[model samples]
Target: MKSELYYNQDRKRRLFVDLWKEQTPFVDNENWTPPPLGSRFHFYVSSRQELKKTFGGWRTNETNYGFNNLSYDYGYYNSNPIPLQPNNDTFKFRLSSYNVNGVYGPIIIDMGTIETLNFAFFSGSGNINSGGVPSTPAFSINYYTP
Candidate 1:
């Protein structure tokens, strides 16, 4: 199976990611886009907390940090909206493990404006006989200013 991803940021500063996917037996393909930013954007993680208690606030080994464990803090990675600087402003974030491909990681995108933004993703791989069949993709965004 293969996949692709896409994202769009409308004038309202909203973001959405879509995914297209196709399998070998199933020649058909489908696309799905995730919700925009600030639409119930929240994260529950414990990587930082795990390392704090295990390693005592020091970077010794990478394995100390695990997933979904109370050893670390479970909070939103980005709960606050990026401040637009004077003259030129850019908003960037790292995306990891959206589906399971492990190929798409950390993408930097420009926050064009405070409007509605959308994005998408597609996944698939085949020969000349088969078209570009991608797996389902998704992305979401949220904004908060202080």
Candidate 2:
């Protein structure tokens, strides 16, 4: 269910963009190979949409899933399914663990769970490191328009 935490059109600009800097590596360090789609997903932002932009060094496992907020917390929602990038293109970012260059995701977010923002290059398999080759960074100034 949606919440009262939304803003009207004119008020919508008051909403801010959400950006994550560090994310899980798209491939394993051993051989830099991407797993199949639906192999994994990541949850973003432990709290509501209260920051200008977030640099995620945190994990999905840390957030309490009981909380719920979209317009205010997660900062993103999709009516139609997000289109997956073609030709193995993905958003480039850094690895959370090593702080080195890492490429993964166009950052697919699932707003269905109102408790937290779910992120994964692929949709639902739980395998991990399944992102493709890098083309762009997920947050290039206007990643989200609020």
Candidate 3:
């Protein structure tokens, strides 16, 4: 009986790991789209270290629809010599409704002098659809230096 119980536990653990792997995003690819109904996702922006200006937007298909609740946090690397001003090192924004029909936009934002940055996206309650065909949202981040 003990051996049977152990087998069941191990099987459950493997199943959970498989599910997580499927949900994990491939951060290395710029064109990699995230699961449309994912509750949370994050990516690092270290390649555009010299970029001082950044703009980006998101879009979703009709089947996936727009995000009911969305929020994001921006974090910069702390080791950099340049000191980030107040409200520069960390920031968060909430969007109650993001249009699903069209592209969100070329929203400009200050990236500061930080070389490495982390961007995370979170979906609000009832926003994620756990089952069904996985849909990926279209998004982009453009960087520029002056």
Counting clashing residue pairs in each candidate, in order, gives: 63, 6, 0
lDDT of each: 0.21, 0.25, 0.25
| Alpha-carbon RMSD of each model | 21.5, 17.9, 19.5
Off by over 4 Å in 2: 1-21, 28-41, 48-66, 69-146
What residue pairs are clashing in model 2?
A: 38-125, 39-126, 39-127, 42-119, 48-73, 49-73
The residue-by-residue lDDT of candidate 3 on 1-146, one tens digit each, is 00000112222111000001012433442453542322222322111111111234322212222333434444443443245332355545454654322222222222222223333222112121111112322222222111
Q: Give the clash total for candidate 2.
A: 6
Backbone clashes counted, model 1: 63
Candidate 1 residues 103-138, lDDT tens each? 212222221222212111111211110011122122
lDDT of 2 at 26: 38
Q: Which candidate is the best by TM-score?
A: 3
Give the per-residue Cα lDDT of candidate 3 at 122: 20
